[model samples]
Each structure stands twice: as C-alpha cells, then as structure tokens.
Target: MTTTPASPDSTMEAIGQAVIEGRAGDIATARQKLLDIWSTTGATGDPLHRCSLAHYMADLYEDPAQALAWDIRALDAADSLTDQRVQEHHTALQVAGFYPSLHLNLADNYRRLGSFEAATEHINAAHEHAPNLPQDAYGALLRTAIEQVSEAITQRNTAKRASAPGHPA
Candidate 1:
C-alpha cells in the first residue's frame, strides 16, 4: 500500500495552535502538544515541520541551554529546507528570509548561555542575512532584536532580552 504524505496545512495549523497556547500562558500544554507533534516529524521528517516545531519549542523553555538545543535543531532543519518547499506552503515565504531569525535566536540563546563568541558569530550571521528580510514590521522587529543582541554581546551581559518574543513585554 502506498503511504500518503503528511499534510503541511494540518501540521502548520497544529503548530499555530501550540503557539497560541504558549502565547496565552499555557506553555506547559503547548510544549507538550508540540512535543507530541515532533515525535511524528523526527529528525529526518519534514524539514519545514521540524524547523517550525523546534523554533517554537525553543521559546517554551526559560533555560538557555534547552533553548539552544531546540534552536540548533531548527537551524539544522532550515539548512535542509528549500525556498520552493517553503513557498509551496506559504506563497509569501522565502527560505532566505528564515535565516535571519534563525541566526538571531541562536545568537540570543548563546548570549544567554554566556557563549559570547558563538553569540557574536550567530549575530553576525543574522546581520548578513538581515537584508533578505522584508521592510515590514516583522523585519523591523528582527532587525531591532539583532541590534539588541549584538549590543548585549558587547556589554558581555548574559541577561535575557526584554524584547525577546518569549519574554513578557
């Protein structure tokens, strides 16, 4: 019997729900749901699903080391991803645009872990990829965050950024 591929739409919908739960202050439930979904994706499953799942999963943790692990997984899946695949799921999405955010998160995680060298490396990577980001508000936000992380690195401050998405604004 032939196997049917998992639908990206459904995967994205589930991911979205988990993100909403996390945003609504139900991080434990959201993290559990995403973990359940991640079991299906595995390390070799869909790159898009792995990337999105790991990226959000990273945010659910207050521990920098834990976030770093998930962010690394997100970055690895992103390295395996393609613009064509991303565009197929969302016409407006370009894989190039994903690098900036991925690198920024890695930078932030590393900074919080007191790995300033790695944080600088990732922040630089984020800067290099920033031009691929659109001029929209989301892009602006990432850019501002990149700057914040970079400044924090220079200050050798290992504190979590106030502007970070997972943090209370």
Candidate 2:
C-alpha cells in the first residue's frame, strides 16, 4: 500500500500544530520544516499562508531579536491580505480581524527586547482591534495572553523607572 503526500496546506498546518503542541526538544525539527515551507512560499505566496508561516516562525526563535523580525514580517503579510483572500484561505477570520492577535504578538516581542514604549504601542493597538476578533477558543486565549502581557509590561516598566537614579522610591 502507498500513501499520497500531503498538500502544501496540510503540510503547513501539520508543521504549525507541531510547533504549537511539541515540547522544547521538538522545536528544531519543526523550525526546519517551517523554514522549508517559507522558502517554497516566499514573499509572494498566498497572503494567509505567508502570515501563518511568519507567525509560527516567530515562536521558534530563542532570540527575541530574531522573533521580532519574524513578527514584523507576519504583521506585514497580514496587512497585505484582503477580505477576499482571507475568505479564499477559509481561515474563519477576516483579514482585518487578525490585527489584534498580530499586534499582541508584536507587543510581546517588543517587551522581550526591552522596548517598553514600542511594546505599549502595540498593546494599545491590540486592545483597539480586539473587539473585531471572532469569539473562538484561540481568540479568547489570545485576549487573555494580551491582558497578561500588558500587565507584565506595565510592571516591568514601573520597576525600571523606580530603579533609575534620582527617581523617588
């Protein structure tokens, strides 16, 4: 018996699942697969495909700088999408509707890089766009994550300011 190969969409989905569900030991392989998909798709691939690939790729990096680069790419890909393209991909969410989560991820990435100002900007963008998001499991989780990250960023910035010279304790 022989099995047919998975389509690019299925393959990408599988890679995304592995990255989301896999343990730390599994990341290297998942990252390589995601990279292979990205090489095939390039910048001109389906906007949804590029967005998904870039979004997952961001999580595979250990370095915040590298992750930020991928996050920016993901946001760009998302911005390039049209409502028709979003429907074509059957993503169950509109193109504009992805901004909140994308912005949230950007905020997290900026916070990781110690750019609190940039992080705060993205956090505000995320909150502004969040109401358009679908009421799905992932949407709820992203909302919760955004709230937690926003609070963490605020706390960190406060601590940093308090530690600075000549600042009142």
Candidate 3:
C-alpha cells in the first residue's frame, strides 16, 4: 500500500489561513497536520509556518509554559533552515564571532525564571561578545552590553542583601 505525500506549502498555507480566521480547532488540526507531514515525510518545514504556529500556540493554548515551549520550537525551526539571509534566520547564529541578541534572550529567559546568576552570566557574555557598535540589525554587541549592565545592577542589589543579613531591602 502506498500513501500520498503532502504538499508542504499547501499544508502551511492552510494552517496560516486557519490561524487568521480564528478557527482555533482548525488551526490546531492544521498545525498537527504539518507536524505529521514533517515527521513522516521529512520536509524541511516552513520557518514562517512554525513561527505562526508558535504564536498561535502562545496566544491561544491557555498555558504560558507551553507557549514558551512553542516559541522555542519556532526558533529551532528557524535555525534549521537556511537561505541567502542567514542573519534573518536565527539570532543564535554567530556573526563576526558574536551573538549578543541570542545571549540576551537567554539572559532574559533565565532572569524571568529567577535564575539571576545564570542571567547575569549570559548578560556578561553578551557584553563581552558585542563590546562595540554593531553594524547589523541584530545589535548583538549593544544587547550584550545592556544585559550585562542590568545583571551588574542585580548583582549589586544581591550583595547588599547578603551584607544586611536580616532584610533583603
């Protein structure tokens, strides 16, 4: 028995339309259809489709954590495929040997999760990696500097609390 392969573009378009129409059930169905096609047919999958699906999952899925997971998956999809504009693909890609924007994302995620030390670490990495005016839109260097400065501020406050020994004010 033979099965027909799905048209990746068509499936993506349907998913996009479903999202646009606010058909939550249909959108989920279409997204799952694409996932099934990608998993079974080995399609590279459309980065934009994954991004849109991620947004849909984030906005409509009723779970903040799941939404974040979908967002990360979207980023993963974007990273997996490549074109002439590699910079447009993933912020984590290194250019001139630095990726401050990616690090900043990492820092912010960590900060939100209350991992201040890890956040500070990545923020400092962003500063060290960027260290100068960035020429590209990523602003990797500038992002790193900003996050590093913010991490420093957090560190100072933490140290103050430690010295006080009774209050964290």
Candidate 4:
C-alpha cells in the first residue's frame, strides 16, 4: 500500500519540531521549507499553523531586527485566531497559552538590540500573563527566562548609568 501524504498540520508540526531541536547545519534550508508551507497557507491559513511558522521563523534569524519582525507576525497571527478556531486545534495548539513565552522572546529580541525600554515593556507583558500559563515544564522555563531577562536588563541599565559622566560608580 502506498503511504498517505502528511496533512498540513502534521507537516507544520514536524517542521516546528525540527527547528526547535536545532537541526545542525544549513538552517536556511529548513527556513525555506517553512516559507514554502507559509506560501501555501498565505494569510488565511490555519491561525495556529501561521503562528507556528512565524514563531519558528523568528528563531532562524541572527539579526534582532529581522527576528523582531517575525515575532510580531507570529503575535499577530495568534491574535487573529478566534476562540472557535483555537478549540479546533486546542489539542495540538496552545497559541493562547503561549503569550507569555512569545512576549518573553520579543523582549529578548529587543534587549539584544539594546532597546532596553521596549525590552522591559515586553518583559512586563510576559509577567502579566504568566500566571495564566499552565504550571508545566514549559511554563516554568518561560517564567525563569522572563526573570533572567528582567534582571539582565536591570543590571545593564545600572552599569550604563554608572559609566556615564557625573554618575557615581
């Protein structure tokens, strides 16, 4: 018997896993594959699928500016998803539950670019919604990451002030 082709959702999940697992070498190739899927889905694809594609796409970039763009797109796609649509993929989709992590990532992206204010803003947003996240390993990880980033920003700003002229060390 011939094997059946994978469904779009399955294909998207596979691609997302590959990216998360950090497949060695030629990340561009993997990103291109994601782009192909994205092209097929366009703006009207399953919101969860679009969000996943954009979220993973953000990680593939070395430049903070580029990554931030993808992050924004991912957030937008997530926001566009309706409660009914979310329920459709709820078993496989936690887009609503992922807001904290998404904001944390966006904060990190902004911090890397030395945009401390924006980073702090996103970090606050992450903290605001973090309590809603399930108390699972992934949720714990995101919470820890948010705290780490927040501390880093605080230290960086303090150091910057200390080094400025007329400021006490």
RMSD of every prediction: 5.3, 8.6, 12.1, 8.8
Model 2 misplaced stretches (Cα beyond 4 Å) = 1-25, 157-169
State in Å the error of residue 32, model 1.
Answer: 0.2
lDDT of each prediction vs. the true structure?
0.90, 0.73, 0.47, 0.71
Candidate 4 C-alpha lDDT tens digits along 91-141: 444456778878877887787779999989998999998886777776676
lDDT of 2 by residue, 47-141 (tens): 77888888878777666688789889899999888877656545354776789878987887788678999999999999999898767776787
In terms of TM-score, which candidate is strongest?
Answer: 1
Candidate 3, 1-169: lDDT as tens digits: 1213233456456655656544434546555654554464342456545544554444333332443465456556545545322334333333433235444444544554556787687677666766543455445435544655465448643222121111122
How do the residues 1-169 of candidate 1 rate in per-residue lDDT, one tens digit apiece?
1223334588878998999999899989999999999998899999999999999999999998999999999999999999778876776777889899999999999999899999999999999999998888888999999999999999999988888877463
Off by over 4 Å in 3: 1-98, 131-133, 136-145, 148-169
Which is better, 1 or 2, measured by TM-score?
1
Clash count per candidate: 0, 0, 2, 0
Least accurate 10 contiguous residues by lDDT in model 2: 158-167
Candidate 1 local distance difference test against the native: 0.90
Q: Residue 100 in model 1: shift from native, Å?
A: 0.5
User: How close is every model to the real structure, measured as TM-score?
Assistant: 0.94, 0.78, 0.38, 0.77
| Model 1: lowest-lDDT 10 consecutive positions | 1-10
